[model samples]
Target: MPETLPAPCAPEDARRVACIGAGVIGGGWAAHFLARGYDVTAWDPAPDAEEKLRRLVAAAWPALEQIGLAEGAAPNRLTVAGTLAEAVADADFVQESAPEKLELKRSLLAELTAATRPGVVIASSTSGYPMTDMQTAAGDAARLVVGHPFNPPYLIPLVEVVGGERTDRAAVTWASRFYEVAGKSVLTMDRELPGFIANRLQEALWREALHMVANGEASVADIDASITEGPGLRWAFMGPCLTFALAGGEGGMAHMLDHFGPSLKSPWTRLEAPELDRALRDAMVEGCAEAAGDRSYADLVAARDQGVIDVLRATGRLGGTTR
Candidate 1:
């Protein structure tokens, strides 16, 4: 690896950002950086990648505009690069949203790390893979960190940042602060945990949901309503831990845990994932189709984007300062 370059200006002052692999996550990152008034160049290999990315960004624009764009924010500020090297050659920061395949990630990240100017931060949008694994092939693993974002990245503001074994502490700090500057709620994790935090919890719940479906215990719509009409409303503002704390009546987590700890052994949970057999797969697909009703995938995405914007606004997060 080449010697590390001196650290540059704070990420907030960064003028250019590169988004590699212009899929959903990459395109979302491009949309986000553009909305923040940064010049963004994106690269992906698909013949239709550029067109798809533009459409995705165009779809996300109204929600971002509703939240208030930066002074110079414009879609025209985005550029589609013909190659990965071209994309990150001059980028002050690079956000990679490539495919989840580990080998692909390892090779792509190494290439990205080599191409970008030294000391520039490179963040991956991996949901579950620890940075330790992804950074293995990077030239300067010290500058690589995971910057996981939620779906519909333009509307959702939460970003989970963590560094791998070889990552420099300064790189972790830099990425965390940079996400905040980019208008995201930063979860600067101290250590890398499997699936990070949110995905672990979500997967646990998701597994149980699949189990219920396999056992004919619940429909997809039932699962959705059980949350939307039940705990989902509270969860929008207060997380599950705090909500359970409130569940202890006058007491808090200690009391609630004391009362509910014994129930942990209850047979209600099926932690092991149900085999996704043809029947189960068809059921899930049909359930989603039924749930989507007359709406197309694009329609559902649009609805979700606007709904998330409304939730952020209601919760006092939309357009709020992240510094």
Candidate 2:
């Protein structure tokens, strides 16, 4: 694990936070911070982005309150800034949730780095891009790090802290504490890897799901059920490795590994990654539509959010500090 540092500011002192690119992820970041009692300044160039971000934050509060994550934080704590520099000028932490394009991110980070104070950590919300690219454009490269949060960050607790080659350990440490205090589960990356850990793991399962549908081995609905009803249940409490250990009975992982070793070479195992084709992509969309039945996207998102709240509350992880 990377060294953990103290929070950049005490909970009471964590007031000024800046968010650049108030899109989906940026708006989520703003919600998390504002809901945690921080004064959030959000900036975006899109026409009506400020109003959209405010609406998004407002919509998120009820769900967050339902999950017992929001305390007494008020909506007025959120402020929209006209310029990127103005948003970050007094911020203790600067979060860039801009587009995934490398060039755009580089430009934003450069501006944010120059605007913010010396010790303010600049975290990027890019899903797959490496920090090295952003750091190259940052005025103080040491303060720029990847702080990718899962979707709907105000609801999900996981946040991946990735450090680039030039990143300072102290910056990563401070960032971990900052996120933890904001009600997030922080995972530090040992080294910079594209997609980090969780996304890569998700992609692994997604690849198999797509392949199964493409091969006609299972419909999209069946595959969804296979997970939502099967491994998903076990995964709620124990991860795959631990679940396998229990599967081995008295033998544990070594025993299970020995038994499954032969299957490793089988074609059923996705040992190699497959390229996504147009046909498979279309099949996936169709399968998902079939699985949807009468449920709309909005309904599905609400249901999924409720499920997450239930699981977290049952596990006593909701609004609970791990550290």
Candidate 3:
């Protein structure tokens, strides 16, 4: 914390955002910010990063238009800065989407903190790394936080916000409020959890899926079908916990847990991830290729975007802060 750190502006009033890194997650973030009517400045070291980022934002514009944009929101609001320092020079908020290497995160965050305005919050789009580990290199760790989002952040509504050991409690609160203001569903965690909330659940399911695939217990398409055709539908409107609560009929969660708790001892799932050996890797690759059939990457992305839009509409989550 700097002695001269200014009082931060209200999260909802924030207008200009700096996105440091132009990869998929970073670019998706840029698209989301643009859709929310913020002027976004992005910086990436890759030679063609600007071109790719612009293309990504262009591809996502149609879905954004359907979801509804904020006043004056347009894809043209994006600016590809030539350097990271230039990007954050006037940023009201900074979002770092660098690669997942710890050292890279440490150095990049330190640089960002040094470059960004003193009171502006700086967030990382890390999938799992705790802010405590990533904030060590920052000159002022108080304003650094984790703002983890799922892929295609422009569509996903959930963002898990958490602060590290050195992070100021107020900063955590600020980040959470900012995410909600930016039209995202926020899970403001009190303490760091391994993989956060959603990813932890996703990892368990992913591990089980891999184990099944490795053991030839289920085909790739079958596993996908099990979710997309079954629980996934309910999950669109109700979470797994509530969905299970319904299983108890009038008994609610207590009865449901009591009845199902005993069955927890069954060897139903392999929690540990199967080794990504050559055979397993090849199987996963080949299986996905076969499942994809004729759909190109662009086609799949478009299909997914439309599907998410439909689900959001059907569930009545498109209005308000959901989109």
TM-score to true structure, per model: 0.83, 0.79, 0.83
By summed lDDT, the worst window of 10 consecutive residues in model 3 runs over 1-10
**lDDT tens string, model 2, 3-69?**
2233356534566889999999999999888878788999999999988998998898898677664
Candidate 1: tens digits of C-alpha lDDT, residues 1-323? 66364446686778899999889998999999999989999999999999999999999999999999999999999999988999998899999999899999999989988888889999999988999999888888888889999987887888999999988988888889888888899999999998998989899999989989999999999999898766776667556654564465444445565576556666768654455455754554455445556765456556555765677566566667452
What is the C-alpha lDDT profile of model 3 across 191-278, one tens digit per residue? Answer: 9997999999999899889989999999999999898766886677556654564555555445665566556566777553455455
Winner of 1 and 3 under lDDT: 3
Query: Clashing pairs in model 2?
Result: 157-185
Better candidate number, 1 or 2, judged by lDDT:
1
| Candidate 3 ranges beyond 4 A from true positions | 1-7, 272-323
Residue 303 displacement (Å), model 1? 27
lDDT value, candidate 1, whole model: 0.83
lDDT score of residue 94 within candidate 1: 91
